[model samples]
Target: MSLKVECQKEELAEALQLASTASRSNSPKFALKSLRLGAESGLITVLGCDGEMWVERDLACEVIESGGVLVDAKFITSLVSAMPSGQVALELLVEDGMRVQQGSAEYKVLSSDPQDFPEPPDFGGEGELTLKFSQLQDALDSVLYAVTTDPHRAILTGVQVSYDGATLKLVATDTHRLAVRTIAQEGMGSSLSVVIPDRALRAIRSLPVGADDDVTIRFGMGRLGVEAGGARVVAQMLSGAYPNWERVVPSEFSRTWQVERDQLIDSLKRAMIIASESANRVKFSGSGDSLVLTAKSEELGEAKEEIPMIADNGQIEVAFNGRYVLDCIQQIRGPGIRFELTESTRPGVIRPAEDGDDYFCVIMPMSLT
Candidate 1:
C-alpha cells in the first residue's frame, strides 16, 4: 500500500501507455482496471491485467521507498502524460493513496489495495526458446493480419506456433485467406506447438529491445509468455485443434508467374478504384509474356491494366478479392513475387520469387462469375 519513486516523465508516460492496454475498464474487480506500481531497489515495475492477459514493464528509476500499490491505470496514465517534462516524484503520502509531484505542480490520486490485485499467473519456466527479437517480430508481422476477428470461431483467432528445435513456424487464417511465416532457429530443446492469441503477440512485438538482443518465450500449462528487453507479456492459449494448415497449402502448383512486386501492388490499387463497387473483385488473365488485370461493376463501368510477367504456362484466368491479395503482397520482401495456382477453382498461392523465402500467403479465389 506504500511506494515512492522518481522517474523521467517521458519514460513513465510511455510505460503507462503500454501497460494500459491490458487494463479492463469494465471488469467486476476494480483491481483489474488498475495498474500495479511496485518500487523495489532501483527498479519500478508497472503492470496491468485483466483475467486472461497482462503487460508488465520495468523502468529504471530512483526509488525513495521500496513498496507497491494499485493505481487507476487510466488516471495515472493521463496524469503522467499531462505532467511537465523532467523528473516526476510519486509517493504514498497516506492510506488514501499516492501523490504525483513535479516541482510545484502536484496531483493527489486514490489507489486500490495492492492485495486486491490478482497476481499474474506463472508461465512454465522450462523449455524456453530464445531467438533474435527482429526475427521473431518479423515473423509475426507476416502472419498476424490474417487471423479471424470472429469470436465464435475462437481457435482461428490465434496464430499456430510450432518449434521443431531447428525451425519456428507461425500461421494464421481467417478462413478466406492464410498467412504463414517461418524462421530458422537452433538449439531449442524439445518440440513445442500451441496457439497463442494474435492480440498478445502484437502487444509484445514493439517491446523496447536492442537489435542484437533475443526474445525469450515460454509456453506450457495452457499459457504462453514472452519477455524481451524490460517488457513482458503473457496470455492464455486458445484451446482446440487448429485446422490442418499443411494440407491447405498446395504441394504441386502447376502454374507460377514471377512478376515485379511493386507492379502488382500498383495495378491492384488502381484496379480497386472500380472494383470497390463489386466487393473488391479483380479478374486476372495471364497469357504469353503479359498479364492483364480487369475489374467491373454494373454502376462504375469496367477497367483493365496489363503488365509483363514471365509465366511458366501459356495462359490462365482467375478472380480474387483484391484486398486479400494486397494484404499478402505488401508483406513480401523481395522485388519479384511469385503467383502460383492450379486452376480457377483451386486456392492461389502468393510467395516471394527469391529462394529461401519462408513467408507466403494462400488466398482462396472468388468466383469469376
Candidate 2:
C-alpha cells in the first residue's frame, strides 16, 4: 500500500497526542503501544487502543494517496511536536517504512502491519443524553477525584452517572468519602444510568469541548460512547453495581455549621501538617459561633486553629481525615461552606452555603483516640 500526506505540524501533533492517551505506557505487545494512521477523502484519522480503551482523531489534510500504517504512538507524536510550525510531510517508503520530513530534518520510522492493529468497535447508538460541556466538565471535576483506586473494588473506581432528561447527577466514592454533583441538562428524551470507569470519564473531560458545545452520550454493546468537540470517545463499562450512595448519606443532622470556605480550608491545611505522620485526623468542635480545629501527632507535635462560624442546634464535635476534608473543600465554588452532622461518629455532609446548590459530599468520620 502507498500513502502520502501533508498537514500542519501543530494539527498532527494534537491528533497524535489524543491517540497516545489510549496507548499504555508499558506494554509487551508492540501493537498496543502503536497508533494506526489512515487517510481517505482529504482527511487523516489516527487510532490508538490498549484492548480496553480506544481513541480516534480526524483532521483535514492533503491526502495524495490513501493507505493505512501502524506507527509507534510516542515516537510519532514526539517527532511531530518537535518539528517546525508549518507543513509536515509523511510518505510510505518503498521498503515498508514511514518517512516523516519537515524542512531539513527527516526521519524514517518502522511501520507495523496495519492489519494486525485491532480496530475499535463501531459506536452508533442513539444519543440518550445531551449535556453542555461546562456542566459535564464541572461534574467530572467535582467527583472524579473521589473514585477509588483500589482494584479489588472495581465498582468504586467508576463514577455513577444518572440522568433523567432534565437533571444529570454524578456520584463517586472511595469508601472513606463520597462526592456528588448534579447539573441541569437539555435535549434528553429518556433517562440513562451507568457506572462509567473513571479513566473513561477523564478522557471525555479532557476533550476540547467548546463552551457552547453539547456532548451527546450514548450506551450500547456494553460500552459507553461520548461524542463532543468533533471527536468520539468509547470505553468499556464497569460490570458491577455501584454502591447505593444516597442511603449512606445522613437523612437528618442534629447540628449544622456555616463557615467561610477559605478559613476552613486554611485551618485544615495547617492542622494537616501536624497529623501528616499519623492518620491525618483533624477534629472539629463547634458551639454557638465558635469553632476550633485541632490535630495531635505523636511525632509531629500538635496544632490548633480557631475559625469563625455560625452554628445551630447546640454543640457538635467530629473527627475526619484532614486530607479528605481538604479534597472536598477545594471543589467548593461558593464563599461559605455548610457542614452538617448527626453525631460525632456519623458521617458529616458538606455543601456550599448557597441554598439550592446541588453539589455536596459526605466524609466518614475518623476514629478519635
Span of ten consecutive residues with least summed lDDT in model 1: 182-191
Question: What TM-score quantifies how close candidate 1 is to the native fold?
Answer: 0.88
Q: For residues 1-369, what per-residue lDDT tens digits would candidate 1 score against the true structure?
A: 578899999999989988887898887787899999999989999999888888999999999899988888999999999987999999997765799999998888988778787778987855667777777778888999899999999999999988898988899999999998987767854578889987788777868888678778887778878877788888888999999988888888888888999999999999999999999999999889998999999998998989999999838999999999998989888899899989999999999999635999999999999
Q: For residues 95-115, what per-residue lDDT tens digits would candidate 2 score against the true structure? A: 959999988888999997888
Off by over 4 Å in 1: 78-85, 91-110, 273-278, 296-303
TM-score each candidate.
0.88, 0.88
Q: Candidate 1: what lDDT?
A: 0.88
The stretch of ten residues in a row with the least summed lDDT in candidate 2 is: 123-132
Off by over 4 Å in 2: 1-3, 78-110, 123-127, 184-187, 296-301
Best by lDDT: 1
CA lDDT of every candidate: 0.88, 0.86
